[model samples]
Target: MLTKKLNRFNTLRNQILTVFLFVMTVVLLFVGVTTFHVVSTLLKNNAEEQIEQTVTQANGRLEALYKQLDGLTNQITTNMYVQQMLLKEVNGDYLGFRERQNLQQLVNSFQTYSDGIQSFELYTSNYKRVFPLDEIDLVNRLGIHWVKQAEEAKGKMVWIGRDPKSPHFFVVLRQIRLMDRWFSPGGYLLVRINPEYFQFTDFITSKTKKQGYMLVADRDLTPIFSNFVGDSKEILHAQQRTVQQNGEEYIVVKQTSPLTGWVLMIVTPVSALTDGVAILKNTILFSGAIGFLIFFIFSLFLSTMVTQPILKLTKAMQRGKDGELRPSPPISSTVEINELNDTYNALVENINHLIQVVYEKELVRSRAELKALQAQINPHFLFNTLDALYWSLVEKEEEELAQVVLNMSELFRYTVSNSKQDEWVTLYEEIEHIRRYMEIMKLRWGDRLLWNIVIPASCFDIRIPKLLIQPLVENAVLHGIGNKTDLGIVWVTVEDCHESSDIVIKVADDGYGMDEQTKEKVNELLNNKEVSSAKGSGMALVNVNKRLQLYYGEERKLVIHSELGQGTVVLLKIPKSGEE
Candidate 1:
């Protein structure tokens, strides 16, 4: 019972289901783990990239603000009115009233920039006079620190650092140049901008709220503006880095403004970026478990559907061991499984039909063999009886009749003896049989059927099929000499030597030869495969041709040449070694 149970477990269906389940489990587990790792890595990378891009965009905006301030400063310093006024030859002088009014109008035109620019100041070098003289106090007149920085800038714009008196102050300074000479500065222009005018809130979106913050700092690593307060030198200067602060991990990304020499830094918390990944991980785990359960059931169903038909076919084949074929039950599954079922169902019927056909054929073959044996016996008896009659005719002194009986009996004996063995004999034995047949033919036609045998002595011992030459001789007498009115010569010639393995034999007759149609018909009979059982007196050539081919193959067979009123030549090629 235990062995039987184990065998049942080992059946093809059970084994297939087991393997399918095992493979599916392995594949699903692999997919789950790979998917988790890939999605987690993807989410983290996307978060880092988004943070970096935000910082870079904020940096670009800050750079644009700096460019705008620089443009304003350039415009004031390069104004033709201001340039020509500063270039006047006065050693120590004040601008004329009209020049002062023109400069004031230029300053007033820029009043709309009050959002970022606090004020514009112009200091002329010739008189050391400042623009907006009405608003300047006597005590705070020149701003010597800014003036020195503006002198250092020459004709270029420069960012002036915060003034100690005004902590929130940002200034851009530039030297005014003369009309014709670039290096000769006419005066200076200074523009003050409020740092609070920059919108840091633009970099922080609601989706990223509490996830990260940004900072803008100067080249000196001092903060110009910051949403998250920090004084760390690394955060201000580092390009991209990871840092731990207050027991929390953060990713820092930074971008530099080319116009202001300031750095834009983004500080992002690692947990805030990856906090949603934990839920994703749990969801994926649940989905994987559920997927495995579904796959297990699917594999069982698939394996059962695939293997059930095969098992049924196998059982039917096993029952066929006793020479019985049983039809397997039909299965409804894939096309190939159904095909197998149909094939097995038809197998028994085909096998039984074949058996019946083979039995009937064997029965017919047996009867044919019996009739053939009986026929062979009749020929043997006839030959023996004719031999006895030949002796009796010799005793009565009838030499001609006795010679005819002897020749006929000899031909019959040779044919019957060889029919039993289908044996090979020496060319000399075949020649003797042909001579006897020719003698009988000569007696029938007298001298008109003249014959010659010119075979070489060397060829006499060559082995050949028995009675191979007699049929050709009979064909010659009947078709060639028998129908001729004048004296006809039938010549049999053979060429053989020790130097060659092939023996050539030719039979030529000078008699009434065949016409084209007759020649073709005779050739067809010789070439036909069924010539062995061919009927009629013309079968002599066909039988000889068939026997030669059977023994020496098709190449060593009879060839005939005949023509009307010209004579006939039959050529036969035989191997010296006969059929191998």
Candidate 2:
């Protein structure tokens, strides 16, 4: 009988607990398996970051030292006194006894530039001079291999790695030009360095000091020096950063210095990276089961209380569903049920009122649409009337008057077409439409009003909201320069802003500009969304601003730049096709 009961699916308690247990077990297993992988990935990333940071820090210091050494070379080479001596030698003139004494003292003074100067020697085609002549020449002293490098570099400094005699020191060689002329090879200046003052290894963070070791290599990747316990050449020349030697895995990270063209690398064992991850991941998965068990017990206890409130709410909803629509009884046991009851009560109270309100809104919307249609009237009727006026003037032999009337007819024809609810027009159509409007304005103002349109023909195919630029042109004519007697120029330019993937249209007029207060007011009016529709050119400005925002977004609003006497420039940007 116990086995039959266990096999049977009967009570909600048994069914719920069994399904919940299966789900929680699957979830816990998934969390445990994935947690180990996630922790491993995180540790690897942190290790790579640590090693890379160490290499960068150490390389940065080394590059700084090299730059300082380069600076010292510049200081001694460009010294005016040095230039005079080099020129004298390049001219094949022998130095007098007094001049040679002066040259030695001048070379002796260079020791003050850096304390790392192990030896300073200058070689000329005519003769040779050394600061401390007792010290053997390390530059040419170790064969002419370094001298050839310096000679090949012309006048630039050539950096050779370490001195084979004393590995702790390095050498720099340069073939000095005659008075800074590259064509004239005057002499060679060689300086041996003791890097104790500049070569710094402590820049690497102390935390990583034990995990890995760093090495600085020249452009050819020859290792200058390293702290590796084993051979450094095997790891340095490996094709891949991850290497295995003596049955152990190691990871390498490298960064090349731009200043010195040297490679900085860090090498560490793979074991050090995954040191604590296994223990931490195991601890997390172990504690997770205990925590979930406690949660399961509490959830079962809470499940018993949930059904009562649900049953009460169900009965209330059942009565409403049967045409007794009314408020549900109040519930305070859970915030969810309490809020559900409050929402249902509010819906019951507001349903009839909402229906009536929607009906009224529809009625108002229909009336508005009807008024808009009536206001549009018919464009053809107006067009016919303007046609009659144009012909009447033509019959009287008034050619210019007839032409002005014809342009006016075309301008109004385009403006009235906008009332037909057309939203998009090719930019070419927009510019052409404004051409007629400006012609009419110009014919009225004569020489006082002049205009120019500069738009790439390529941009003519782009579609924009109808009449976008007309209002700006109209504002420039009627508001900006309409009252000024002096000749005012209105420039309309459209540029394809490739960087931003937008088109910028500028309408600028050099007229008596607005005062600070009025300009502020006009700007506020353009940005104010609550503005009511009004008549005249001002409303036209607002409508254009509103349409730009509606078609694009809030960021597409018109930008106005103006000052007291510099006039005003209105800038508007239209995003490319997909940008909208």
Candidate 3:
């Protein structure tokens, strides 16, 4: 069941359709989510900004009112006539003319700056007075709480919410200090503030009736004033907080008055500022749905255009597996697909040309192998002739000469046998072959040719590539001993280096050695891995060195040293099996 379901989508068309639908779905989902989030954030930010502006305007007005009242207190305290009235004595029931005039002067001062002031009273340690007096005299003694608060304030103005037993008025009280008089307690000044003068409720009501409401609270969180009639307890204590009431969300913004330490809080509904967010959110969701459908169709079409050529090329490649080198047809709509078709055709043509070239080269190689096979017959015939010569010497009673001929024939056999096999031979067998060559040389130059083989017995059993050492021995004979007129000593040594897992072989010759230039040239040729074009002098050494390097690697190969009239030493370093 799962296989059948998977096979439905396995076709090129279905796979492309699935991919396009998945991508379009993800893109539509992302766009819808991002749009909704942006609308929500912008609405919230805009509401907060509006509420903040309302609180700022309200706080500014309240601050201005408090500043005017504060200035009124300053005016009374600085007036000399008011101070004089406080210092005067009360003589009779009715004040004397100067006393009454001085009292009126104090009342005139209150009238001058008392726009919002309900009444002003001066409380003295020695006397008392009230402006706009009633028929019944009222004692104007400072309240103990006001006196203590004023002292604590150090003569600064103190604002009180309401007068004792009076709910309709607030008061500002201060202890007047005599100017230029040290430690002087002059009198107390009290100004009754009519609550109507504030106009805070009307201002707050005008701004918040449709949206929300506003509240003013004292430092203790008491509801001093507000246009909001709902439960304002939370709003009073809230610090720019959010609250839900009656299933409605509200943002409470608070601003504190620096002058009175009163907080002005504006409570605005979340829906008021974000009125169009619902419309915007619904619009985004609807558009996203439409966009998803459109993108799905467009992506499906695009994928078909992209994959059709690829499917055609794949079919062509499958057909080519039957040994037919066919090229895919070019896609007309796509330049890249056309280029791929061109490249595929070019590759097939090149491969056919390569096949023809390899066939011709193979024919030439077969011919060369045949020629090499025929060349081996000449060496075998030489060997047979040498065997006959050895027996003829033996019959003539020349035993030493017969032995020399026998050794020469043995050397020829070793060379010709190894040429066919081309396999590794024991070091012992290689040294014995070297001995046969030395014997022939001794017969020619008799006691003048002194030679020694000082190879260790343990090293002789190690196998090395055939003909590796024989060519070096030949080089010593031809270049070293053959060039010298006097007696020459040829020495061969093999040392087994167990520590380095190697066998070190040396062939030394005491003959007319080469100069610096010749030594350098011979060394360069020996190290040269490239096949020699000219088989000139020292070609035997170069070929041997190249073989040793090929078999054992360059690190374990020939090292040659030579100097004029000194001697030549050629060392062959052979690593153990697999050590190379």
Candidate 4:
């Protein structure tokens, strides 16, 4: 009986070990297969994405080149010098010798001003070449075709046959307008453009690794210029294949010059553009392979050790999940494993305590600061002053003055309503405040102070630091207009600048503008080391500058421009934030 019992125990242990090994093997296979598929799929998608980005960059470069060439052509044709040369006497003959000489000079000027020109010439209305007789036969022949086309299409420039001087030359012809008739032979301004001028070799070779070639072609599908040397048939076939199969992966930019009926085409291969993407794809694949190998081996060792502690700890975790805080079984293998468990528990406790402490402190501080700010000033003083002004105006029997006092009181109320905090006000609200202040000034100074306010509707919604504009207006009125004997004009304008994403508020006063010495004194006061008290001169401007810096950083600050006896303009450049 004792032997049978021992044998039964051994048999049970062997069966459990066999089951564990089988489960581990299955898990390893699943993990390895899944990781491989996911990583491989990710690498392929990333490669395609990189290829698309390369195509976009290539398109941009091509577009830039096309634009540069188009601009150069347009500048040449429209140049005052070229136009004058076209109008000059050709030789000394009214319509013959002098005309030929002028035409020759114009050809020389075109060649000198522009590079990559294989030839330049001029043709008369009768198919007679007037200049550059070297290509006279070719010009006369091409001129017949263009002259016929020019008759049907009036006033428009036409491109004639392939250039004769350069193997890859393209010609542009414009009918020069004379005083009399539209079709009267005005002579053609012919230019021969080398296709090599537009070939961007650096971009193509660097991107395509010399495997791909770039070529410029005319509307006839004939290659004007090519960077790669090969049989024409092979080159054409490769180009056709690339265009048909992987055209989407390539970049093609076409620009037509309105001045000259010439088309600029730029073509770049996708593979050349995104060579980095291919490299990146390979790097990721290699790294993923190495990582998988390392992980697979490490997983084998880790799996066996993982199960025993996991089972023991999982049982304890299950108890906690059921609402019992039980300690996990101590892992005895490594010191790091034991420390991880301890640290996790300690971190959770510390976090919970810290959250509670922060919540309590915030609530306490909010209440205390609000109380302290509110206790600084009283509302009764402002109310009593307004009431006295109202009574005085009533006694004087001035209804407008009493109304102005009421408006001023309302303005003051809005300003002091949020005294406890610095707030942002809409440009419209600031403008309204300034208008109220201006009204009060108008009542005091009458016709002596003339004010003009120009504000755009778009700038009305932009937010500014509260009370920003009012201080500047106050400074202008008190120190500027009040001290001047001459009648003054105060201009306030608000400009909305969408490009720079800013709103500019400008206030100018044409009264007693500061001299250089006075300006220097004011600047000194603004940047003075003394606290807010010693900087009495232009204190309002200084305060505004400080507040602007504090809220909007150093970039946004008050700018002052003043000329003695001329005017002073204060510009405030504020970023447009829609927040009220």
TM-scores for all candidates? Answer: 0.46, 0.43, 0.44, 0.37
Q: Against the correct fold, how does model 3 do in TM-score?
A: 0.44
Candidates sorted on lDDT, descending = 2, 1, 3, 4
lDDT by residue (291-321, candidate 1, tens digit) is 8889878878888788877877787888888
Expressed as tens digits, the lDDT of each residue in 1-580 for candidate 2 is 9888767746455556667777787887788778878888898888888777777777777777788877887777777777778788777676666775777677768778777688767766433653444435434455568777877888788888776666777777777776655557777677788756554456554747447767777888877667767768887787798988888898988888887788877888888788867687768777777867876896576655665676677787788778676777787678987887788788877864555445543453454457556655775787898899999999999998888899988776666553334557788989998888888887889989889999997798888877789988988888889878889999999998877778899999998778888877777778776534467646656767866765676678888888888888988888767225
Number of clashing pairs, model 3? 0
Candidates 1 and 3 compared by TM-score, better number: 1
Ranking of candidates on TM-score, top first: 1, 3, 2, 4
Tens-digit lDDT string for candidate 3 (507-571) = 99988788988988887886664555467788878667655655554565678888888888988
Q: Per-residue lDDT for 338 in model 4? A: 69
Query: Candidate 4, 519: how far from true, in Å?
Result: 99
Least accurate stretch of 10 residues (summed lDDT) in model 2? 126-135
lDDT string for model 4 (1-580, tens) is 9999877755433445545555655665576567656765675456445434444454455456445544544454454544444444332233456655765675576566556666666655444566755335434456456666765554345545476444457766665554433224345556677766566667644653424545544445466556644343343434342343323444433343343323334444556545555565566567656766666566555655655555565566576566555455457755665675566456545655445445543443453346445742666787779979988998999889897988888776766665435467778888888888889888888888988888888778777767888888888888789887778878899888878877788988987788999888778766652335333568888777766654565466678899987778999887787431
- Poorly placed runs, candidate 2 (over 4 Å): 1-23, 46-61, 87-117, 126-129, 134-140, 180-183, 195-198, 206-210, 245-248, 271-283, 292-580
CA lDDT, every prediction? 0.74, 0.75, 0.73, 0.62
Kindly give the stretch of ten consecutive residues in candidate 1 with the minimal lDDT sum.
134-143
lDDT of 2: 0.75
- lDDT for position 476 in model 3: 82
The total of clashing pairs for model 4 equals: 12
Candidate 2 residue pairs in clash (backbone atoms < 3 Å): none
